[model samples]
Target: SGRVDPVTAARIGKVLGVDALILSTLTTLNVAEVGGISVGPLTVKGVKAEVIITGRVVDATTAEIKDSFEARGEEIEASIKVSDLQGLSFGTTAFNKSVVGKCIREAVENFARNIISNPDRLMTHQIELRGKVVKIVGSKLIVDIGSRSGVRERMTGKLIRMVEVEELQQYVSVPIGEVQVYSVNPDTCILEVLWAEEAPMEGDYVDLISLK
Candidate 1:
């Protein structure tokens, strides 16, 4: 199960009730000895472990690959014995402390950072949701939307404040700022304001902008 095909991804998505899925495969894992190399005043020889991973974001409903990325990790141990790398099983404490395990961890970390930095790349379609700013503390804004409303972490929204037009005698919804959800609950979600023209207040409206 190193690779998740489109059909398998779709089936898993349906069972998990998710709109999208991220599939990753370990493309390469290698351990090589670096022959003695000059390092300033001394020659250095070491064992190097390298790992390469490929990742994809698939639209569960359409079974389409929306985005793809690659990450790599490498670790080198100077003046080390190759025997130390042998007989190491996956997930063991000793293995985790080994160079190979560290390489894998770094690769996964790189993958996560890549996804977090490019959120729009994961969007297969748009969804509309509206909620209210129920509370505020410092720069944190609490919204009414929650997991029950299909809300998840990392979702972003625009805060709208109503302005009364003196001449028109009507209230208009004006976008004041933006916020990204960081925490979620069954009936509520907490957001950190990204920016604001005016400080957000309770009773303001929220227009959902991004899906988690």
Candidate 2:
């Protein structure tokens, strides 16, 4: 609501295949030199840096605020030797972004620790996959989910198919089989069949359910 707009929430829901979503926001990520600095022929430059970062967790569907956190970082007062106080045009001293990066990391990690496992946060490791099986090799079931989709070794999935019954007039993707990731590439993953009610044939549906 405050951060995730309707279009963004819809797009994210499509990707996650979930009716709800947990949203994280970076409210503040800023860095500045607090101490005074002497420029151009005056004198020296003082280096006292300050960083502030804030994070907020929200529910995309309910438009509710779940949690919020703040973290701060600072660089102690230091001296930067001036090569040329009165340079012709530009000097070669550049402020480093790493200090601000540290602050952001602290803020984000703190936020994750506080809210990731909370029941109200609605966080899950589940990954939704929608693609057809390409081929099979012995007990191995290879699919189109791979590094790009965050697939890794030892990850598992459930094989399902939408079947229709003339009497019921509805389609369902039942857990016909279970599979484990054996190997993976950038855009492909090889899964080893663990159990199946019936042998899975080519062109079947493969759902790499989750990473955690």
Choose the strongest candidate by TM-score: 1
Q: Candidate 2 on 1-212: residue-level lDDT in tens?
A: 25665457656766776655545445554444444545655554444434455544444454444455565555433244223222323222322333344444556566566655554435434466655678888888778768887787887778876688778988778779888889889999888888899888887887776523
Which runs of model 2 end up more than 4 angstroms from their true locations?
A: 1-125
TM-scores for all predictions = 0.58, 0.41
Go through the candidates in order and give each one's C-alpha lDDT.
0.85, 0.61
Compute the lDDT for candidate 2: 0.61
**Candidate 1 residue lDDT tens string, 99-184:** 88899999999989999998777777777678888889877888898888877788787888989999999999899998788898
TM-score of 2: 0.41
The residue pairs found clashing in candidate 2 are none
In candidate 1, how many Å is residue 42 off? 2.4
Query: Model 1 shows how many backbone clashes?
Result: 0
